[model samples]
Target chain A: MNLAFAEIQETIRMVQMESLDIRTVTMGINLRDCADSDFEKMNTRVFEKITSYAAKLKETAEQVEKEYGIPIINKRISITPIAEILGNATVEQAVELAKTLDRAAKELGVDFIGGYSALVHKGITKGDQTLLDALPEALSTTERVCASISVATTRTGINMDAVRQMGEIIKKASELTKDRNGIACAKLVVFCNPVEDNPFMAGAFHGSGEGEAVINVGVSGPGVVLNALKRHPDADLGQVADVIKKTAFKITRAGELLGRIVAERLEVPFGIMDLSLAPTNAMNDSVAEILEEIGLERVGTHGTIAALALMNDAVKKGGAMASSYVGGLSGAFIPVSEDNGMIRGIMDDALTLSKLEAMTCVCSVGLDMIALTGEVSAATLSAMIADEAAIGMINKKTTAVRVIPVPGKKEGEMVEFGGLLGRAPVMGVNPFSSDRFVSRGGRIPAPLQSLIN
Target chain B: MSQKRAVVSVIGKDQVGIIAKVTTILADNHINVLDISQTILQDFFTMMMLVDVSELEDLEELQTAFDKVSNELGLKINIQLEEIFQSMHRV
Candidate 1:
């Protein structure tokens, strides 16, 4: 509070200019009430609950912004899993529900809507089974519809049975809507210990225990933090970390203020401020930029793991200082299309799925925003998912896979999503096969009680 | 109304009456101290406070008020935007 040193207004201006503003303020709405045995009642009730609950989300976020002068970018809503609501309903009914939610989001003017999902982490319950079966048609037909399947867990291990099922599921999902650039699967995610209240998606869904309404804000500034680090190139690790810790603190503050404001206006409980550096297609703030600052020219390399570990730790450390509740996968995201620098790394042949997976072990979300070739087998895709789930289960972190199998395209080809669904140059897959392993069509026994160590 | 908390750190030589003088200024301005801690390393004295001033307009007001305390106590003071304070809970 030394007024003589620098004006408080100057400090505020410094924070405003240096920090990246919030990426999104998401209201996680539990749609358990949407469940109904009757198909039509289920659909109508489902539509009404989500549409009404989220209608004010974006507007309220904007209001909070103008009132506080803190910019909260996206106003999104994540609902309960679609399969849970589609009880006793046909797959067509599920697809119809998907369309209804999509229309609701469109009406609300939200950039994206999450929660067209199913979770099979422990085991695929009847509801999860139905959701799995309904995903292909539901995703193919609906534009804003996103889907997720968690067929593995730390306690229950990998569901080879569900994995085999999803292998076929993903193939059908890809083949059915190749024209939408196989965009349906792109909106889908595969997860482990998937948080119900996650504000980011195509995998966001209100957890079973979440309040009827809760607001979570995801504050991202990997690009901003990366830029700050760039300013101190030759500094030692401690100094660089000091810079990151400080940047995360300011960003989290902005997000905390926004979350409280949005939740108050929406009349929902403010959940927590997620300090995840949710990278976008923006140039300077991408995860690749952060990695580049860590001495790697690209994200896929030998030192990538160390760079990611340092970044993930520093973000959590810094963000933790700024909020009472800092949750979600609070680390760097290496999504392909959504991050322009990551996309460039892919196009330049400097990035690959293996390296992405390796980096995910040290990150919050594993192998997200990745695009695969259309020719991949459901079995191989399942194997790829199994690979990621293994990492998540072992690390006990929230990890997800959002793969876009660009329809009718081969590896090395790039497909343009047009709009925020940015373009991706299809990545090559490992030639080696996992058919025998994946086709076992049963659960892999849980890992040792003690870690592999 | 939005309220921001700051962790004010006073680091300098460990001299007599450091706490007595700093507390006087804060109390004079009616800025209630939510929490405080002190530590000594070698001849240096470090004191930190978690103070809430939703009652005040801006940090400048707090800084202007704290200058009287800092000058008399000969302490280097930093008002950290307390959201940046180390998280007490671990995940």
Candidate 2:
């Protein structure tokens, strides 16, 4: 046989048994051309442009999935951040534009349409303020629209004013969607050092520097990594890292091939492949499980940070060698609700908000998909965002917070968002207040590392 | 056009006419079987066939035919483009 038996069998096992699959193939379409002074004309242009460009996205992804015999789980679209073209629109017009985006997403048959975003790392413009004001309404009213705000970056300090506003916006969104356990907040993310080409939703947007249209793919294979580690029980930590690297190489190669084919068929440039080990709600498909397989009894316990740091580095090392262009948040993800092992850890009291915050320092993203109590003050939420932004700013890595404060839910209780958002136990936050600190609204100065020439 | 190749794999309890059944479908679809390898590990029969699908259209149709054969013969049959394996296993 041209291919070794073990190689063929390994691929089969990875797909069939382990939950190896492409998480998303996001097409970033520049909507700057769709901008117009007239609100109705702008909406029409935006809708038409997205529909025309992404009309074949779903069909092409399905065709590729059938041909490769691998699942492309999500076909999504990311546009130029809405705030960019909002110009002088009012908050009501911004919400209407979000509805148009939601309509475009539905027309294209994509589950989520990202880029309802605003970048306010340094300061907020009129458009940014309008979008921020419209978020609570736009997110609650729209089904498929995902929003993100970049509140901090290494080059520009954390925007404390925006962070404080976001905390209140999150609370209002939760209250608006109180019936659905704050599902709207699940569709919103606050980012620090956000990537323009990230294929994952709620944090994905086509930056100003991106092309007219590009294809970015996110590959997921925590189960594949977990199974590889399981096969080598006695290997030392160094050898274990080797196993993860080899597995990641294979996963990234498959992702690049798939992304390139999709891009070619669509006749667009292949942007990048985000080799994030994004976990799902499925059993045996958890990044926490990989950490535990590395000898941690439970995630969020002591030594979890070291284990995650090792796994994240090895994945990057392996994936970097396989793909020529690796960008976005390309490391391990530790979203509690989306990962079953993490949900279990939360239920067992082994995982807490503090531990997850620490884990974010080493992992790809931060404090992702966690649920907190409704009574938790907006000040506390803002403080949480500040802490995470600090980590991302100082370390010069991307981090984000996508916490859902389920109304009427408290710690140790479960809030179910269903589907990929999964269900997470409401985690306890510090009862102490950071009201005075966050209330003093001003930008935290950029770290000295940003002074690099 | 260059040859479009695929790998068809079948695994199940050792049984009769497994090769005949799978090859019959391939032959009907005008797919050329370039190579074949089979082995019985314990009581399970595992077979792999590399075939050229250049002339074939509608891969889903061929997959459906294989699925029917799979259900009838009590074996698991999967047909995937050969490039998937090569890209992952090779440099």
Top-lDDT structure, candidate number: 2
True-structure Cα RMSD, model 1: 9.7
lDDT of 2 by residue, B1-91 (tens): 9989999989899988999999999999878899999999899899999999887774899889999988998888999999999999998
TM-score of chain A of each: 0.94, 0.98
Query: Each predicted complex: what DockQ?
Result: 0.03, 0.80
Docking class of 1: incorrect
- What tens-digit string does per-residue lDDT give for candidate 2 at A226-302? 99999999999999999999999999999999999999999999999999999988889999999999998988899
Relative to the true structure, candidate 2 reaches a TM of 0.98
Cα misplacement distance, residue A237 of candidate 2 (Å): 0.7
Q: For each predicted model, how many residue pairs clash, with residues at least 3 apart or on different chains?
A: 4, 0
Query: Quick one: best DockQ, which candidate?
Result: 2
- i-RMSD of model 1 (Å, 1 decimal): 9.8
> Residue by residue across A1-453, what tens digits does model 1's lDDT show?
322122233233333544466778888888887788887887788778888888788777776554343467788888877766666777667777888888888888887788887777666767677778888887787777667777777787877787778778777887887777777777788887687667877777777788898899898877668767878999888887788888777677667766886788788999977888877775565778787787887767678788778888888898898888887667777778878878888887788878888888888888776778887877788888888888888777777777877667888888887776678888878877899988777777777767467
- Candidate 2 has which clashing residue pairs, if any? none
